[model samples]
Target: MSSDVIVIGGGIAGLATAHELIRSGASVTILERSRCGLEASWAGAGILSPLLPWDYPQSVARLAQLSNSLFPEFIEALTTETGIDPEYQASGMLVLPELLPESSGDAKGLRQDARNQMAEDWCGRNAFPMTRVRSREIARALARDQEAFWLPGVCQVRNPRLLQALIRAVNLAGGKIVEHTAVAGLRVERGRTQSISTSQGDEYSADHYIVAAGPWSRQLLGEHALKLDIWPVRGQILLFKAQPGLLDTILLQEWDYFYLIPRHDGHILAGSTLEEAGFDKSPTTEARQILLAKAHALVPALTEETVSGHWAGLRPGSPANIPVIDRHPSISNLYLNSGHYRYGVTMAPGSARLLSNIILDKPQPVDVTPYQWPR
Candidate 1:
């Protein structure tokens, strides 16, 4: 097989994996159902941190930490290979928790405040930099006057440009990307993948096969999908064209996971709702109304008039937002690298490194137990 490996899906996970494999001197090809990066990889706000890292399991945080550590060098390599800048920036994040006075009898509000305190403790133990500041101290445009947690080390990359760079880099590194080629099924003979069949009456043969199809991983795998819990989580985002520097930091609402991320070009993205609406990627009017109201409440500059775009992306929702980055137990040469519920972009490099290491039999930088296949 000239194409040593076949990657099913061309989103961040697949592209990053292909890039990693090529870097390791492996021949690789990516098969995408549509144009690359037009899905969740492009639609995301590109926050590099696990939202409230303290709230997630240790495995999630560890993987995220590894990825964050790799981002700088990874972005530099992509930019050098392709003349496109992914706009990777340490934009920081401000987490605003709704606090209640001690005199208030609201039990839910008290629990919320307690969690904020717990988050502070977690940050301390993890050696993650965090500071307490009034909302106005950082990103003075917030409409409310409240204290917030600021993680100055949090970073973000422009998801679309990053994908473009990755695609170009992969091509430069002798990797093939077959777009618009949806896989029909895998030809498994004697616990090994012999070839992959496609919907276009095409078949591809590779020494190894990886399924990184994001939310559609299970659908693509069919009966081959093991005890996988990957499902589509519909998330809608509202884009606002605002003045430059209107909001400098990523603002996250602790009560709900609603967030506002501002690009360098004054485009602020406000999202999103975690609705288990199946595989539907349609943006609902109700989501728009709710997001708009939240955006306006946070920054007075954002309103219905300033709203420029509304879009939706289906995330690969999983248990505890953990992803599977291991090989299939039944199939010897088949692997999976999907189900990164929310931090797909954030976990791209680390997950890619981990998966590629598994395939190459290279030493791992972290324990690979948490990302193992489910049975």
Candidate 2:
């Protein structure tokens, strides 16, 4: 079918973009190779914060914070329209103190000495409410003997539920979604994308084209190759049946580079392993065990719970960890909203808004300079 805009990929980025475009009176069509929202968008744990901001670029942290601010109103409108609960919760995050070094050869003393020295270096570099605590203090807090330090602003959404809500919103908004339809190549004429050919040998054309194919964006762009350095970083998460009163807030073990998210349905989602395995979505037993051990070490109650599930997804990673959201330099009618990596779900609404502004020639809510089309 012909339309004003053809969006490739039906994950969160594509759906949100289509929703925004349609809301602005653009007739949009989404082409999904498989089921919409069943890939990275669905597999995501849905943490809305750039929890480890100290490790990311300023652009990423800014975008995440902006998106996090936009979520409340977004989810409210979505639930009102689709009657699906996005499960947006503002449950803060807790950073447990690391254990003391083992006393083998004065290691504990040496480690404390090192931290004392590093604390001086970290004084002005890090933010507030951060400190070096003894492992016994962390264990005591988990054991309810001491108070756990809280980072007040972390939040999360029910990701799979959010996708379902978006699907309903898209259909209800009069937008069309063509599932199992893979675009093999774009049909460009006179430097404009007029149509796209699917793997089934059918051609569908539109007035505008949007590529939000996540990790597969580079391949879909083909010889035209939009200078997107998007790479697939594989991450695996383990789900455990949550015990009552076990985890009240998200736990981020800063040094461990892992987190624990508590869901409304008594399930704790602990993830993830970041490996550059190149489009591989398989989960390894070793990874699972490592995650489980890490979870248990932080919250010992996890060992008593049962493993509910395990899965992996490919995050569309980039070198600078910022997404590309601009019109293609060569193809005027073509645009992109991909390479979001771990922040796709968090940045969805903001990214969609930015792309919509670009498409409609309206003023953007956030600066789109950093996410420009590659040179």
Candidate 3:
């Protein structure tokens, strides 16, 4: 049966958009190459914001803030619809500035003081709450006693649980989900999408089609993709089953682009190495050793024995971690909403809202110029 919209990709982007569409009174059918939510969306650490929100462009910040604001109601609705609670929490993030030590190692501290000043300025301008405090003041378990930035507005969610709830909620809302159906190509006629064909020689049609296929969006669109800068950047994460209370906050080392996120169930996720591996999701021993060294450096309790798992996922790497959430420049009935890089889950609801508004021809809350399909 044809659907009001055909979403090609069952990852967080696809699932979120379909759920939003269903909420907006549009029928949706999600076609996935494999099981939903088992991809990058599941493999993520579930941190609801960027490691350093101040480092990104204003466009990224707006989208993230919008999505973050919508998260409470989003999680509530999902929990009300499904029994799963996604474990949403205002678990703050602790930022450890990269320190540069002189030979004596006492005269020098806090590398990139200019960046910290920029961070402080940006936070003041944006009204984002942040405080400078000693690491030991907040996290007694930390190995060092350095000054850190305390961002209390940050949040976290069990992304796997969130995706599970989203899938269930969509199904309960009458949206269809078809797994293991890899969309091979789009059938376009007269500046609009007619149908999408799968590798199994079957076709699915919809009034409108969305290409949220994550890293594969540009390839799936082929010649139809005009100046869409999207590729796969592989990230590997390691899980350690440490005591839950050992770490109470999201610990981030901005210089190395590393973070350790704690869960309610005593599992701490240490990640991740952003490697330009190009679609290779295989975990490597070298990367694992590097991450373990970082985790051990901060919290000595996370040893090899406590290690539980290691896996990798390909992020839809974009130029500046900003996603396109607009209709195709020429194809009126087609849209694109991928290329969120590492912030897809963090930006899901806002991106979904933007795309749904574009589809429904409604007014947008934020400026839609930055996210327009590339000319």
Candidate 4:
């Protein structure tokens, strides 16, 4: 099928791009190897902001900031259109740093504390309110022995529901989605993609193409030898069903690099190991144990609840953990919008908005030079 824009991959990036393009009066079609919105888009913990914003580079922070700002309106519109609540919550994040005794405020101890203090300073500089408070003030679920900082502006979404809403939004916007259809090969001619040859032995052509295939994006590009820095990093998460109000805020332990996320419906999610397992999405027992131990450490009451679910998804890891969201350097008609890694859900709206703007030659909101393909 021919269209104005053929988005390769039916994840949030592709669907959001298609939705924006359709709203701009462009005909769009999305091709997915499996069902849409079930990959990293669905499997993510859906913390709508970077787990630690100060830890990322400015390029990553810029897109994340814009996307975070855009999410409320975006999700609200999607909810209104699709009749699905994505469970968008400004639940805030409670970051627990290693506890240092008040008497021994040495340089090393202060250094560990400085990470949180730095994040608080960054939030203040950016006009976002962040407070360092005693651990017992927020929730009884956390370890009272630790020191914590609260970033109330940090939010989360139900990723699976968000994906469902996106799929419905795309459908409502008159965007065509072809599921269970893989692009076997790209037929490029004279430095341009003429059409994509599918596994079903059919050819689909479009005026322009976007590769937003997540973890598979780099592989697909390598199959066609297109230059894009994206690779698979496997992430595993554990879900525990607890009673409501068991956790009122998102709990983060920076020293351990693990988190406990509370859902509206009595489900708490403890995630994730960033493994370079080469497209393997298997959840290992080792990872499960590690996450479970961390979850219990964060909330002692969590040990009472049975594990509801554990799953893994491959994130598209990129160089410097920044996404490439610009036109392909060689192919004028091809655009790259993959390599979002852990921040896929956090950055989707801005990434899509940027890609759509680039496609339509509209003025961009932020500087695109940092996100461009390195020449």
- Each prediction's Cα lDDT score? 0.92, 0.83, 0.92, 0.86
Order of models, best lDDT first: 1, 3, 4, 2
Clashing pairs in 1: none
For 27-110, candidate 1 gives per-residue lDDT tens digits of 999999989999999989899999999989999999999999999999999999999999999999999986566677578776
* lDDT against true structure, model 3: 0.92
Query: Per-residue alpha-carbon lDDT of model 2 for 153-219, expressed as tens digits?
Result: 6789999999999999999999999999999999888989988999999899988899999999998
Clashes of 4: 0
Worst 10 residues of 3 by lDDT: 102-111
Give residue 49's error in model 1 in angstroms: 0.7
Checking candidate 2 for backbone clashes, the offending pairs are none
Measured by TM-score, how close is model 4 to the native structure?
0.96
Model 2 — which ten-residue stretch has the worst lDDT? 138-147
Q: What clash count does candidate 2 reach?
A: 0
Q: What ranges in model 2 sit over 4 Å off?
A: 100-149
